[model samples]
Target chain A: MSERRTPDVLPGYEPLGAAVRTDDERWPTASPDGRRRLDGLRCHPSAPVWTHECGDLLTPEDHAALDAWTDGLATDPPAGDDGPPPAVLERLDRLLAVVPFYRRLGVDRWEQLPTISRADLARAVADFVPVDADLSRVVQGTSSGSTGSALVIPWHPLDIARDLPLLEHLLSRCGITWPRDPSRLGLLNVVHQEQAFTYASTMTWRDEQLMSRVNLHPSAWTDLDHRAAFLSEVNPQVVSGSALTLMDYVDLGLPVTPLAFVSGAVDLSPAARSYVESRSGTTVLDLYGLRETGPVAAAYGSREGHHLLPRTIHVEVVDDAGRSLADGSAGEIVVTSLENPYLPLLRYRTGDRGALTGAGRDRRIVGLEGRAAVRFVTGDGRTVQSVELTQRLQQHGVRAWAVRQRADGSVLARCLGGNHPALREAFDRLLQQPVEVEPVSGPVALGPGKPRRFASELGQ
Target chain B: MSDPLTDPLDHSVEGPDLQAMIGRLLAIPPDFLAGDVEAGPLVNDAVRLAGVRPAGDEAVRARGLGELALPERLALQVGAWMVAGPPLAPLLRTAPGEGRSYDGESVASALLSFAGLADAVPVARWTGEDPERHEEVVRALCRVLGLRPRGETHGVAEDRWVAVGSAARRAALRAAAEEQRKAEELARRLAEKRAQEAAAQYTHV
Candidate 1:
C-alpha cells in the first residue's frame, strides 16, 4: 500500500510551531501541501444521493442562539495576555464552588488537573459524588465497557454549552466556518453511535438545522458505489468520523474530499492520514474526546495534532501511578471537565492511551491510540482491531447489524441485509478460521439501551 | 407433546390455584424472560391481568380473551402466551403453529418481555394511536428477535397492526420528547434565574 503513496506529502504542521503566531490563528494558516491535498480529493459528479434540506446543516438563528448562550463567557481576545484569563478563572471558581467533587479533587482551574483515565474516574464516581446527588441525572456515556467498570458520568447543561465554543473554534481552524444555517449545508457524520448521528438531523438544539445525517458507521459501509453515492449526495463541507473510516473511502477510490475531515476515537495511521489527504484534498483535523467528556481538544492550524480547549476542560497526560507526565511523555489521558456540574467528572481517565508532543511553550498532544477495547474478536482468537474492521466492513456492503460471540466460541453475525456469501468468505479468509455464519432471519435486535458493535460472551 | 392427564407441571392440571400457577411460572427459566431484570413484574402483571384459572382440562379463561388464545394446557406459559387476551391478541398474537410471521401476540409478548427486562421502559402504556408508529413498534420488536422483517411477512398485516405499532412508537417518542423538553426547560429556567439575579445585583448599585 505504501507503494501507492503519493510523492507530494505535506511538511509537518505544528499548531504551536514557528509558522503559527498565536494558537487561535491556526485555522487560517493552511499548509501548502494540505491545501493541495484538499484540492485533489473533490468528489466526481457521477453519483446522485439525496441532499438534506440546506437548513438542516446550519442556520443563522442557531448561530445567534449559540452566541447568546456564550455571551456570559465571551471575553475580549487576550489583550496580549496568555495564562488563564480572568473570565476563565471566574468560571473555574464557580465550577469549583458548585461542583463539590471537583473542589475535592482540587481542580479549580484549567491547568490544575492532569490527564485522566477511565479507571480513575470510576473510582471517583464511587467516592466523589455528593452522597445526595441523584446519580441518574449524570448518566454514564461509554464507548466501550469491555470491563464491567464503565465511566459513569453526570450530564450538565453548562458543561455542554462551554464545550461548544471550543469545538466551533477548532472546527473553524479546519475551514468549517459554521454557516448560520446547518440545513443549507451538507453533512456526512462518521461516528460510532446512533444518537449523535440522529441528533445531527432530528434535534433542534441551538436551531442549527442539521437536517441530514449521512451516517457512515465506520464499520458498516463496504461497497465503493454506496460510499461514492453517499458522498456525492451529501456533498458535505465537513466529513467527520473515525480516521480509519474516511481512509476506507480513499482506499476504495471513493471521494475523500471535504473542506475539513475530522477524525476521533482511534489512532489515525500515518498511511491512512496520507491517503485521506491525498485523495480528499482536505486537511484532516484531529478531535480528542471520550464518551464521558464530549469534545475536549481539536486541531487548529497545524496538522501536527490537537490543542486543548482550555475553557471547558483541564487536559493532562498522566502516567500510570497517577502522576502527571511531562510534555512529550506517553501515558493515560485524564480529563477534568470544568463544565459538567450535573455529574462533575474529575480526573476521568479515558481508556485510550496517548502522549503529548513538542517541547515547553509549544506543547500539544500529538500521539493518541483511541479506545481499542471496543473491538471485535474473531473465532481464531485474533482481535479485529475496531478501526481496521470498520474500514474492511465499510468496504463491503454490510450495514447495521450486531455481532455477538456466544459462550461456546461460536460467532453470531447479524445484518439488516447484505450479500452473505461474500461477507462470510471475507471473514473466513480474514479470520483464517472457519466459523459458522448465521443470517439474521428477522429485524436486528435492539435492547432498551444503545446497542454495541461487538460483544464478548462474558457481557459488556 | 401429548395432552397428559393432570399436566406434569402440577399434580392436577385442573384449574391451577393462584399460588400454584405463580410458583410454576416462577420455575420457568429466567432466560425465558430473556434475562430481563423487570421480567418478574411483567410476568406477574400479564398473569394477573389474564387471571388464569383452572377449569376442566384447560384453564377456564374467557374465550375471545381479547384477541389472543391461551396455552390451554401447558406446564409454563411462554412470552407468546401473555398476549393471548383481548384486542392485542387477535391482531398481532402468534400461536406456536401460526407460521413465523409476527402476530399481535408476539408483539405483546415482546413488549411484556422487554418491560420485564429493562427498567421503566414504556412497553405496556404507549401514548398515541398511529398505524405508522405501530409498524415501527413491530420493526423494533423484530430487531429484538434478531430477525429482519422481510419476504412476504414484511409489513403484511393490515390496518390494525399498523395502528397498534404506531401507537406504541408514538407513546415512546412522546415520552422521550417530554423528558428532553423538561430537561431543556429546567436548564433554561436556571440560566434565566441566574441572569435575572445578576441583573438585580447591578441594579442594586
Candidate 2:
C-alpha cells in the first residue's frame, strides 16, 4: 500500500481510508492566488486549527453516475398527482427485497407501510440499511438537531455529491450563475455554536474550488473580531448556514457580501429572511430539508412558500394515523426519499408540519413550520442560541431532552436519559442562572407532536 | 395401561362412546384446556410427526415445547392430536393393511372431521384457570387414546389429573417470566451497541 502525504495547507488533517481517490489523484496544490487567500484565512488572529477531515470521496464511476442522474432530472417531466411514479415504485420494490426493515413489514403497497420516526432510527439504524450495501465506502454522520434524538446516518459520498446538482438547479431557477473563480472561495458553511467540526476542503465538483466549514463562536477563533475579518478575506461566492447563524452573521456587521444565502436546518421566518437579504443586499433562499433527506425544497426571495427541488423524492402531508391527507390540509410532513442508496426512506416521518399546495413543478409547501428558531436570554442579559445548549447537552451524553425558558428568565429542562446533576450544572453554567432539570420517562412528556427541544416565552 | 374398551371400570366410555367423546374434547380451545399455552409449536409438532418439516430448522421448532411441565406436555399432545386431522394416520403405530384389527385411516378420518372444531368449543366447565376443568378434557382424551384412567373411579382420576395440571400451569408461568427476562437483556445489549456506533464518527449536523 502506498503511504498518503498530508498537505501543508490543511494543518492537523487526517485522511479517511474510505476516500476513493489515491494520493496521486488528489489535487497537487491550490492555485498561486488561491494559496494567498488560504494564507490570509489561516493567518487570521482568531482562526482555529482545523480539527477534522473529510472529502468528496467520489470515484470516476460515481462521477459518471451523478452526471447521468442530473441529466435525467433535467429531462424528466414533473410528477403528477396520481401516485408515486413508476421509477419510485421500482426502487421501493427493490428496497423491500434488500432492506430488512421493510421486508419484515411485509407490505407491498406503499401506503400500507407504517411511518418511521427519528426515534426508530436512533434505536436500530442498521435495520434500515440495505443488506447488499457496500460498507467499506460508507461514512457516518450524527444529527442531534432541534429534535431531541441523536441519529447516526450512514452516508455515501456519491449521495452527498448529488446535493451539488440540486443546489445548481435551485440557483439556476433564480437566474443566478455561479461562475468558477479559482481565486475566491466557492462556498462558506458557517455555524454559530460553542463547538463544531471545522474543516477546509476543495470542492472537486466545483473545479477544485476552495470550501470550508467555520464556527463563528468566540472559542473557535483567537479573537472575536477575526470572525468578520476572516469572512471578508474568504469572500465566498455563496454562503450557507442555518437561519440563526445567518442572523448572527448579519448582526456581526461584516463588510463581505455573497451572491446569495442558503438558510436551512430550521425554519427561516419572513422577517429574518428579509432582514438578512436587505442587510447583505442579496437574495436569501430559505431551504427546507433535514440531514436525513438532503435538500427537499427552496423558497426564493420574498416567496410565500417553498417549491419542491428534487424530481426523485415524493413529498406528502399525512395525518396522525399515517394516512395521506388532502393537498391543502396541514399535517406532519412525510417524505419518501430515494437520495441515499444505503438508506431508502419509505414514508419517513420528518416531525415537521406543513401543507402541500399545487402539484408537479409548481408544487409548493405553504405554511411550513419546522424546528423553531429559539433564542434564550441569560440572567446576565447575554443572548444564547439553542444550538449552543444542544452542543453542551450532547457532550454530557443526554440522549433526549426538551428545554424551555420561561418569561421570567428562569429555565426548566427535562431529559430522558443522562447524568441529571451534570445536565443541571451544564444548563446553569450556560444560562447563568439556577435552572431546574427534571428527569422524564420518555419523549412524550417533552410535548405533543414534535418534541419541542427548545422553547422560549421571551418573545421574538 | 389397560384398554378402556376392555376395562370393566371404564363405565364413562359406555355412556358417551368414542366419537362423541373425541368431538367434545376437540371442541375445547387449547387455552381453555391449559392456561396460556401456545398452539403454534403444537401444530408444528403434529406436522413434523406426519413427516413434514416447517419453515425453520427442527431444533428451533422443537425448542418451544422443550422441557415443558407435565400438564403443558399433555395439553400440547392432546392439542396436537386434535389439530393433526388426516395427517395423524401415518403417525399411528399401526400401519394400514398390516392385518391390524383397527383401521388407522378410519380413526384418522374421524379425527379430521373434528379437526378445526377446537376453536368452537364452549366454556361449559373449562374455566382456563381451574385444573379440575382441565382434568375433564384429559379424561376424554385418555378414552380416545384407548387407555384406561389410572384411578379406580372417575372422581379419583379427576382429582389426580387436577393436581398434575395445577403444578404444570405454575411451571409454565415461571418459564414465561424467565423468557421475558432474557428478551429484555437482549434488547439492552442491542441498545448499547447502537449507542457505540452512533458516537464512533465526528460528523454531526
Candidate 3:
C-alpha cells in the first residue's frame, strides 16, 4: 500500500465523498513549487499532515509533491514551528475581539486564554457563541452522551471531511484498507444504544472486500459463547467499533482473524487490548481524538501508543498559560486545524490530556485518559471494565444503561429491563454493589445520537 | 385462531373493557368517585389528573360507555365516551392534580393481555417468554368454543339439541384429531418418556 509521494497531485485526489481503493498507487514526487503552494495554504498558522516531526522521514520531494497535490484544499495548510494556523489565529483574534466574554478576559490569542471546562462551557453557553454568525451554515451533529445528555456540535463540512482521512489512516495502521468497491461497503451501523436493522451483503475478501456487518451496543462481550455464534454467522472481514464494544466481541470468544480492529470513543486499557488481540488475533489500534479535533494520533502496529498525523494538524501539550509543554509532560491537547474553515478553532483545547513522545516533528502521542475508570471482576477473579457489564446487558433486550458509582463504591445502574428486580439481584451479587433496579417506562433518551459506551466521574 | 365458544363474548366474564374503561376510570373526578381508584391523595391525584377519557366519542358510542355501563346508567356512560378528538385535549378529563401514572406502553401491554394476546401467568411463575405459545392456546380454546352454532330462535329446547347435534359431534371429532396430531408429534421425539418417568420413580424409591 506504499504509494510514491506526489506534489499538488495528491490534493487533486481530494476525498470525493466516497472511499476509493486508490491512494495506494505510486505518484510523482513533491516539487519545491508544490511545497510553496502548500506553504501558501499555511499562511495562517496552518499545518498540513506533512510538516510535523513525526513526518521527519518524509523527503523534501514528498513534501513538495503533497503541497502541489493539495494546493487549494482549504484544509491542507502549512505547518509552523509552533502554534495554530494563521487563519485560525485570525479567526480567534476576531472572535476574541468581538465576543464579550473574551473581550472581558482580555485575550487576543487562544494561547493567552484559559482552557474552558465543560462546566464552564455549560455556564457560559450563551456568551461563548458568536451572535452574528449564522448557525444555519454550520452542520449540526448530536452525541448520545454517557451521562444520558445529548450534546449538539455545530461545525462546517470541511471540518467533518478532515476527519475521514485521519480515520482511514488510523484504520490503515491496523491493516484496514479501503474496500475493493466503495459503493457496496455495509457497516452494521450503531446509533447510540440501539442496533439498526441488519442488512445483508456478499462481499467477503478479508482485505479486498468491505462488506463486514456490525452490531450496535457492543455490550455482548460478557457472553463469549453467544458472540462467537454471531460472528461465526456474520463472518465480517474487518471490525471497528467503540473500545467497549470491541472488548465485548473479544469477551464473547469469537474467532478474531480480522484484517483490522479499530477502537475509539472510550479509553482502551492494556488488559482489554491484550484480551481482544489474544481472542481475535486482529491488531487493535487506539484512536486518540474527539468530535472537535477528529483523530489526533493512531496506534502503529507495534502498539506503542499512537502516531500523530503530521502536518494534517498542529499539536500542542501546554500548561494553563498555553506554553508548549515538553515531551512526556502531561497537558491538555490544543489543536488548530489548517483545512476546515467552517468553524475555525484556534488553539481549541481538546478536553483530553496526553503527552508527546519522540523528538522534534517526529513526536507522536503516548497515553490519554478521557473517560472515567470502571472495573469488572470476572468469575476468573480478573478485574475487567464496567464496559463488560454494559456489553452483557445489551445481549438481553436492554438497549440502554448507565452505571453510576456512589461515594461508597457502590455502583447503581439505571436501565431498561423487562425483568428489572431479577436482573438487579443477579447483577448486585456479581458487582458487589447495591444494585437498585428502576424499570424505565419507555426507551431511554440516549442523547442526540453519538454512542457513549463508558461513563465515569471524569469530565462529568 | 377461529375458536369462538370459550371467547369473551361466549363467557359472561366480568372484567374491565379492553379500551376506554381504565383510561376513563382514571379520568373520574376524585371527589365524585370517592377516591376508590387509589389509597392516598397522591395516587388519587395521579388518576384524577390523568384526564383520559376514551380515545374518542366514537369509541364510547361503539362500546356503550365501556366500563361505565352500569345496569341503569348505560345511556349516561355512552354519552360520556363521545367527544372531540384533537388538540388531544378532550381525550382526557381529569382534575388538575390527578394525572396518569401509566404511560402508553404499559397501557398497550395491558390491552394486549386483556385481549388474550398475553397470558395471565403470575409474576412468580412468569418467565416473560412464549407469548406466541400462549396465544396459540387461546386460539385453540376459541376454536373449541365456536363449535356450537347459533341455536334456532335462541330457545332452550333447540339450544340443548344443537349442543348435542351431529355438527357439534363432528367439531369435537376435529378437535380430537388435532389434539392427537399434536400428541403424536411429541411422541415422535419423546418416545422414551415412560422410561424416563420410570427412572425418576426408582430414584425416589
lDDT for each candidate structure: 0.41, 0.61, 0.39
Q: How close is every model to the real structure, measured as TM-score?
A: 0.42, 0.66, 0.42
State how far residue B174 of model 1 sits from its true place (Å): 36
TM-score of chain B of 2: 0.27
**Winner by DockQ between candidate 3 and candidate 2:** 2
Please provide, for model 2 over A287-369, each residue's C-alpha lDDT reduced to its tens digit, 9 standing for 90 to 100. Answer: 88777876777899555688877657788888886788888999998877887876678777888899988877888889898
What order do you get sorting by DockQ, best first?
2, 1, 3
Weakest 10 consecutive residues of candidate 1 chain B by summed lDDT:
B196-205
Model 2 segments beyond 4 Å from truth?
Answer: A1-46, A145-149, A394-400, A441-444, B1-205
Q: What's the distance in Å from true for residue A270, model 2?
A: 0.8
Can you list each candidate's DockQ? Answer: 0.01, 0.04, 0.01
For residue B31, give model 1's deviation from the true position in Å: 46
lDDT of 1 by residue, A172-193 (tens): 6455675544323334555432
- Winner by lDDT between candidate 2 and candidate 1: 2
Query: Which lDDT value does model 1 have at A319?
Result: 63
Better of 2 and 3 by lDDT: 2
